[model samples]
Target: MQAFIGASLLSSSAAQPKRKPFEIYDRRLQGFTLRVQSTGVRSYYARFGRNRRVVLGKVGTLAPEEARERCQKVLGHFAHGRHPLHGIGGTDAITLGMFIADTYTTWVKASRPRTAANTLEKLHRLFRTWYPEPLTAITLERIESWKARRLNAGRSAATVLRDLFTLSSVLRRAVTVGELTENPVRRVDKPRIDRRGKVRFLDQAEESRLRDALKARDEEMQKLRTAANERRQKRHKELLPRLTHFGDHLTPALLLSMNTGLRRGEVLKLRWACVDFDRRLLTVEGRNAKNRQTRHVPLNEEAMSALQRWREQSGSRRRLFDVATGFRTAWEKLLKRATITRFRWHDLRHHFASRLVQHGVPLNTVRDLLGHSSVAMSLRYAHLAPDQRREAVAKLNEKPLLALTMRLQWDGFPAGSHYRIDSMVEREGLEPSTPAL
Candidate 1:
């Protein structure tokens, strides 16, 4: 590297081998340096504001000539009497706190509660006492410095990703709303967090225990409903006991979810018209489902039986499962009383897949039943079948003769006939070479 007047000459094949906006701040580069990466990331100035050299944008869609033009325009604006970013917060003239707060207030209002709460949590956790003081100005380097701070803080990759996502949203929104000329958050690279938490699922024994517990609660509720009707307690202290009759209805809800593997939201929106008693099938329309793909799920006798019981109990020709019926909170209390503490209502759907994989179900069938957008998600239950680790291996073992003997399983598979091929090969006098070999 040679020092160019008020600058430095960095070889294309230098020790670092590549230049990013954050790296320029850590290294001793002279006045102005340019790093043009093959990935189309380009940044203009190396340094030269106040005792420290700083980098600008890593240009891509905007070419090098255009970047040079834009930088010159910025410099000329700074040189002239005009304050181009008069009210902006991150410039040499603006305090960092005002900038980020203003960024949050302006950009985050219309986001959903789930999204908004997440952003708020991440912002408070990651930036709380450590962000720039009110008087201190903000710089791009200060923002990118979060990469190191996040790692040292022992935050997992997901937490770091969430925090960075919040920052990216705020800054990107700033550019669109004309608060800032660009987004600095996008300029920085995202951190890699090793060892993400695996999505927990119910094993076969746990799934059965859960079902037995839920069934016991259901039976108790049914018995209570008959006993309570004779006494007639109004919607008061006795109101909850009457509501507890609704507990009988919970079995069908649980059964439907476990059988169909639909999201809780989709289940909450189910209607009588979607259920065909004669056919014993439930149809969820695309508009109601997350993937917007209509699914016709064949109901097991138990799932259908549960739905029938709900119809007899409610008597209203309205929605099958009313979210406002107060059973949402009721079921939580019921679980505590029942002492089934290992799962959420949503986990019932996961249990659906878990049970199927444990009993030799194909992953693609599980994916289709759950309405997953891809088999990659459904394949997570590979742990359920340690013998058949991946979908490819499982499919390689599958024979077309399965249609002849296997029936629909309770957990949602063509079950109990994993050895249909073995039977066929024995009768036909062919060796079962796949397993034998």
Candidate 2:
């Protein structure tokens, strides 16, 4: 049908078809169209080329005149041999929130299941204001201004850098999928950070206190379990198992991490099949590993003992630990009981690496044991192994054989007496050569 698409025609139900959908072509513009669905839903559209069509927006959301202006812009682009939706993936009207909700979220969830929730939440919280804005509207200047604000608000440079990185990743994905021509974040200067900052680990005194706390906790839990079982027996109920060996998974879990340097995720996701008692090795599956590569960590006596005790206690469960949620609450409680300050669960891994380095383990070996991708990461612990440097410097203090012989020849001379070189040479049972002069 050919007619002028006006506001009154759009608002009136007379133009809406009850049986089938229909399009009303604009009399003013050649390819402008208004599509009215059978259910009476109406939207504006622009038709270009042979069979191309672009839905501008719903009739109520965009007025006929406003849709007409947008349609003209799209048609003008098409006439100039340019893609009507060039920068955007398919539609010029896609906003940041729309793109994230409709596209990026699905891709990220599939590719990065472990961090998808946190990453998506951070994106939503940090860029909520930008949700209504189009992707192209996120310019370098705007990002720079945001970064400045965050810094001025007492956020650390490292944190601001991380935020920028996350934002840039989203924009980079847009560019990769043709939703954007370029990533403006590429032009923004990232905040500087010192990568080699001091690493936190437990000292001897703190480690001792932590061990004492663990032992105390286990004893207390065992007493409670005994009391509970006794009460159950008195009530004629099924007797729960007694607490033997370690109190719970927490003690063994901490020991394993401290010995093997496994990440918290890897430790939580560990399975009985991955542990090899005979080979004294624990395998981090590729799926659980951050780098997506399987790595075998050699289990020392402590790690092996922890795993063995845990297996005996946990029974035939497929996974080693039954912790569905993280250990944040339990960990904080344990740290408080131990009276250890400025330490984190991740510091257990650092403690393992630091101990190995202090014991004169090679940096390359430390890198492999820690599952670091490169030796450079393990270099942070290099200061712990100063014995080789000390030995090298100690060599400078040893007297040479020639110097020892020269000193012995002058040993009998009086204090502060000057000895001739020729006399000294002769005294040392050697021929004195004549000087050229």
lDDT, candidate 1, 1-437, per-residue tens: 34331122233334133444233322333344565554545465534344432344454444444444444544454445222233332454433344455445534655443356667667667666644543232336877787768778887767777677776675566466445677777767777654323545665566666667776776777677767765565433343334333465567777788887878878878889999999988999887887779998889887887788688777666688776663577668766765577668887787777878888989898888888888887767766777754756778667655554433232233345455545555677864322211
Which candidate comes out best when scored by lDDT?
2
Candidate 2 lDDT, 1-437, residue by residue in tens: 88889977866765776688888899889889998898878888889887878778887788888889888877887676444544323545667886787568867898898999999999999999999898888999999999999999999999999999888888887787667889999999888876656879899999999999999998999999999999999999998776787788889999999999989999999999999999999999999998888999999898888888878877989999988877788789999998998898998999999999999889999988888899988888887888998998997886654665556446543333233444665677865333332
Taking all chains together, each candidate's TM-score versus the true structure is: 0.53, 0.76
Candidate 1 colliding pairs: 33-46, 42-58, 42-59, 47-53, 47-54, 236-239
For each candidate, what is the lDDT? Answer: 0.61, 0.83
Minimum summed lDDT over a 10-residue window in model 2 is located at: 413-422
Q: What lDDT would candidate 2 get against the real structure?
A: 0.83
TM-score of 1: 0.53
| Model 2: how far residue 224 lies from native, Å | 0.5
Report the lDDT of model 2 for residue 340: 90
* Clashing pairs counted in every model: 6, 0
